[model samples]
Target: MLGRLFLKLEFKKVDYAELYLWLGSLMKNNCKQRRQFLVMAAGLLAASVVPAWAAGVSGEVKALEGVAWRNDQPLKLGDPIMLGDHLRTGADSKLVVRLGGDVYLLRANGSLQLENKGLVLGSLRLLSGALLAVFAKSNKQIITPTVTAGIRGTGLYVEASEQSTYFCLCYGEVELMPMHQRSQQFRFKANHHKAHTLDAKGGVEKSPLRNHNDDELAILEALAGRKPHALVG
Candidate 1:
């Protein structure tokens, strides 16, 4: 079993630090659990490796539950996620993907479109759904019907609809611009979660953090072979 797992993991590569972290977390487990951890680590290691790409494929699905579609075709774990693809999740579904060093989680009943400039994700258009993501330090944007957010190396969560959008800058910095009122745009930095809502009329309002947490950010960062701020120490 361990050999098979290793062979499977050979498809990708992970950082040694990630391996050590995983080991530390599971060191207290029983023998069988330890084996299970090895298997899971093998998979994670595979995901961290940059595979030889097919044209336009810049990433792959790391975790998937229930049903998902990529460009209207059935999506599966380990499948390459290409640039400019449309991704959707069915009821009760969840999808996690890694691109470069970034990680994203899409919740049930969500639709998102990837916009890439070269190999980097330039923007994410949340057509209608909920998404949580952690990005490596870079300039990027998140777009919704009601708002567009310019972000720099941040962990973020958003839920979008035609009438309103909920946004949480989980960490780092953001410049938020409401669709109907770019004149009212504002910028802020967040050491922790900071929440807001944008309405169709180009209004921005303070909102309470909801539907996301630091633990989820940690999970996403781990999948990308990095640590969240809270776990850095």
Candidate 2:
């Protein structure tokens, strides 16, 4: 019974998660412009619950280079990220967002949605290009075009495109499951192990870890209030 319940809960309609994220921030309170905010965020109450979270504060804007856009606005260095923020980076651009228990590196030509339930990260959807991250022990989900992985205290990298997605769990554990086919789930635990495709049925075989490095993990870990297991003297 317990096993069945777990499996049932694992199957989430992640495609609609983005839609909810886009409209999730409508629920807020104690605003100076309460009437105006409510007008824009009217129907968001059903999507998001009330919580006491720091407004417009998702993470510390550590560094950025080249040009980037946040929700279509020019992304500044010290801008605090709000929930449902759509982040996009252009050529030669780079961005680092340090969140609670996690840090994200968004490489050039990438886009993603920051989705959280009341300041707790629920789903982080990497739309395109490269995204590198190290997560602390927390309930977070990583989503790409073809793959969705449940992450907890994990180090991972993803490069997503319309054709396919490149995924590698650098350290710790991740549950590799397909968005279309949730039955063929694979749980992986290791350092520098790669799972390129979505599933075994006509899916590409696992490849050796490539691209990402341990030092990168160490850097993100430092910002996330932890030390990377790979870092050694």
Candidate 3:
């Protein structure tokens, strides 16, 4: 199972004590800090009321652990998540959400905006952090700080920051390009291969694989009711 695979891959931190200690560090200040965070998010949402309302029920939180927030509120297991919702996960948190036929796993200290325009997902922005995504047979695109990836029924891992974005096409097919240079696009078809870095200055450079494995892909794919097509490296 992918979950089991992730656990094994993370064996370097096999000491449960260390894992718990790391998670403990993510605890927010208190309810006061949470309230302040929510207030600020609400203020920003108010500035874009039309878009927020357009977000309808898209999925449910299949699994949630530790500190995670949805629409200015603490998330609970089985909580329904709507489109256009701004999601954030704190240190040592893990969230699994299924939207339409797409399954997304938001890791610790990550943030992203959810989206589903009518039926097709128009926009999903990973602001700062990383996520693992598995898509059912459909054309969907993911946006990070520097690039956009168009994928079809694929498993992908991504990390975004102001400097660059890391992309791993774990399996299936994906078309990638910089947000600044849409014309210069590339396609990748493989399982657990083809990793790259998209830089802020429109530089698409080959990057060595890091921080992911086939087991992670299997888990995300299972959540999407599919399986990764294991390929020879």
Q: What TM-score against the true fold does each predicted structure earn?
A: 0.78, 0.71, 0.71
Candidate no. 1 TM-score: 0.78
Which digits, one per residue and each the tens of the lDDT, describe model 2 over residues 61-131?
55677888889998876577766788999998877776665778898999989887785778899888889
Off by over 4 Å in 1: 1-57
lDDT, candidate 1, 70-117, per-residue tens: 999999767888789999999998888887767889999999999988
Residue-level lDDT tens digits of model 3 in 144-224? 889988888877889999889999887789888888887888888975678889898778778888876554454444444
In order, candidate lDDTs are: 0.78, 0.65, 0.68
Give every collision pair in model 3.
170-192
Residue pairs with backbone overlap in model 2? none
Best by TM-score: 1
Which one wins on lDDT?
A: 1
Measured by TM-score, how close is model 2 to the native structure?
0.71
lDDT of 1 at 152: 76
